[model samples]
Target: MDAILRAAGEVLGTELSEPVDLGGSPRTVVLRCRTASGGSVVVKKYGTEPDDLRAFTAEAAGLSLRLAGPELLGVDDSIPLLVMEDLGSAPTLADVLLGNDPQAALDGLSAWARGLGRLAVASVHRRADLAALSAGYGMGVPSWDEEPWLLRHAAEFPAALAGIGVEAPPELAGELERIAATGANEYLAFTPGDTCPDNNLLTPDGLRLIDFESACYLPVFMTAAYCRMPFATCWCVFTLPAGLAEKIEETYRTEVVEAYPQLVEDEIWQPGIRRAVALWTVYLTTNLIPRMAKDEPAHRTRRPVPTLRQLLRHRWETASTLEEFPAFAETMRLLLRDVAGDWDVPPLPGYPAFGDFG
Candidate 1:
């Protein structure tokens, strides 16, 4: 610990002390430390593990874009550590959503949408710049935008379902291929990769995002699906009240439409967004189903969070209605019948902020 603080202090030209551990994953150690000048800087040091290096590379490269997040004060790639401006304590979006004010949650959700949309607009053509910075950090990990998530997760679909005693439909492969092709379309933009609710801080100035470790470019719909699935990859899942999801989705779409004017059309917009939703449903099957063996909060510290079965059932219910993929829709239906249908859990409730709605 002394050696790492010393290394980080050298980068900032000030000795750091009074370190407070800021719970990071096994891949990194994050600290909120007081500098010699009595100010605080968050110092993060990545582990020697290969994936840790990749995560470090992504964060350093993403913050360098200055699109969002704390200002990157300094980096010593040799130690694989970062010294960043402290944004100070602020309530996270998760905090707001889980609180008592429905209106605060509503406003926060809209602002979050607008902020992410503008970020996508700002980062549209900067892939190579991100690539160049990434190479300098961790021997050049692959840009996650190009990671073939759709095809890879879809390919795993059949086997994942089979593990649960449900056989995938024969024509499911064709539907998966179609959505994967749409996933590869030209409407790409940069995202912080892990835009889960807790990953961003709702500061007085605006929503200042953090945790750029999974940063990469991806189709805009990959994120737009969050507003539809109402947060596809987040641990803070709950039912959105009537019309709330679409309203926020429009708040986001309104900003991105500035970059791609054709997004104004339902023909161009609906199909892309729905396909992204389908892709994420497949993702949920692989990522969440195995976990359904037990019931617990999706997050360790947050309440009213959905359980794995709750999330899976919600996703499958939505996917079951996809007009574009009959085979896939049928598959979702079968899972609903054989897997989550008999569970004793109540229907997933609305966000806690909505008070009686839940």
Candidate 2:
């Protein structure tokens, strides 16, 4: 912990004190440290391993973009650490969503979606700049939208289904290939990559996003899926109240329309969102199918959370409704019918905060 703080301190040209451990993944050590001026800053240090360095580079590159996240304070390439503005004690969107107050959760959700939309609109013109920044960082981690990453995930879905003794539909591959092209050329924007609920702080100033390890540019619909599915990649899975999601989505759409006017049309917007939903559903399926043999929480500690089986079932149910991707829809049905039918998990439930609304 001292080493991490020392690296940050060296970058900031001061001695840091009062180090508090902020939990991190295997690849990182995060600390909230006090500076000489009695102010707090976050020190994030990445390991020297390949993937860890990639994450560090992406984060440094991302924060330097000066987008909606915490401000970039200092960086040390030798240890690949970042000293950033401390957002301080603010309740995160995840905290609000997981709590008992419905009004607070509603406000958090609306602000998160709208804030993301504005972030998207604001970031539309900075794609080349971000690319240059990542290149300068030298980790060579390609942005999600720049690479055919969704296609890679899509390709793995059939094999994952086969592992569970299910056959892939004949036309599923073709549908996935076509859908993979959605945000590759247009309608692109920068994203923190993992906009899970826990990563979004509902600060008094507004929604402040953090966790830029997987940050990159991606399709706008890819993010809209979060508002549509309401936290698509997050462990904080819960159904938003009926009509509330649409309102949230519209709030986002209203802002992003400034960058891509074509998205103002439902013809373009709705279909794109469906394609993203299908891809994300498939992405989750591929990642989780290998582990669903034993039921586990989506997160280690967070509770009232859905089990792996339940989350997959919920995703399949939603993805099956896509009219544009017939084979993909059929595949979701096949998974729902042939694979997940005997999982013995309960149906996914609404957010605890919204439980009373129903």
Candidate 3:
């Protein structure tokens, strides 16, 4: 804690005091503090491990891009800390979805979708910057040309499935292999590596993204697809009322086409988006199972991983809505049946539990 204040002071050129722990994993220290001048700021200090340093650098690189996010106040690579203006005390959309009125939650979701779309448009001319940000980074969003990290995860999926008592079928194994080989390069754009609602704030201006530890340039469809599924957040998978998701997609699509008309061609945009969504869904869903089922030190700091039954139920419900992908739907059906066994599943919570409204 002392180290964080000292780092903040060094970066801000003022003695920072009165820190409130903002919570973080083992590799991070997030604090909300007050400068000597009485201004509020957030101080994020990353550990010195190779992966940790890379994550911090990637975050700083991401902030350098003119995406829809918090203002980048000051960054120090040596201390690996970022000091920035606090975005106020508004609760995140995740909190709103858990406890606010349905309309308010819907409003926040709309803002998040629109914010991401704007980010896509803003990144249209930042190709060189995005490449520089990604160069030599230890970890980043998986893309076609560079994907060693995702390949490692693919290799572990079969064992992850086995840990939960489900035998991996040959077809499932083959699908995983196929996904590893596929890439979504043509539609690359800046993506918030982690699109969970927890990483954004519901300010009066709209949703403002906070963390960029995981942000990178990836297929624009990755964000669009994740906005519909709980792939990024994993814990909170609220079922939107019918047609609401499509409306949100349209909001995003309109913004992108306005920025880059060349991408609107039917052959390029439609199939690329759908295929990207499917590939991402498969990768995320497979990767989440083992992590969600087992408790680890990292999971201890965050929300408890949902039970296998809960995840299977969520997956099944999500798959049912994707009727266009019958094969994937069939796979979910098979997995759901295996997971159901004889136990009665619990009911999912109703939408809009708490948080900001206006």
Q: Between 2 and 3, whose lDDT is larger?
A: 2
* Decoy 3 TM-score against native: 0.82
Q: Write the per-residue lDDT of candidate 2 for residues 1-358, one digit (tens) a residue.
A: 7677777888999999999888888899988999999999999989988778878878988999998789999988888888999999898888887789999998998898889999999999998988888888865555443467788988777777888888888887777888886665679898898998899998888899999998888889989988888778778887777898899889899989999999989988988888889888988888888889899998887776888888888989998999678888888888888878878877788887876322
Measured against the true structure, the TM-scores of the candidates, in listed sequence, are 0.95, 0.95, 0.82
Give the per-residue lDDT digits (tens) of candidate 1, residues 1-358.
Answer: 8988999999999999989898887799999999999899999999877678788889999999888899999999888899999998898888889889988899889888999999999988898889788776754455555467678899888888889899878888877987888647578899998887888799999999999988988889989999988888888888888898999999999999998898899998899888889988888778877688897777776676777778778888888999678899899899999988788877888788987435
Error of 3 at 344 (Å): 3.5
Regions of candidate 3 where Cα sits further than 4 Å from its true position: 134-148, 163-165, 180-183, 260-274, 291-308, 320-331, 353-358
**Candidate 2 accuracy as TM-score:** 0.95
Worst 10-residue lDDT window for candidate 3 reads 349-358
- Which candidate number maximizes TM-score? 2
Q: At residue 259, give the lDDT of candidate 3.
A: 73
For candidate 1, what is the TM-score?
A: 0.95
Top lDDT: which candidate number?
Answer: 1
Would you list the clashing residue pairs of candidate 1?
A: none
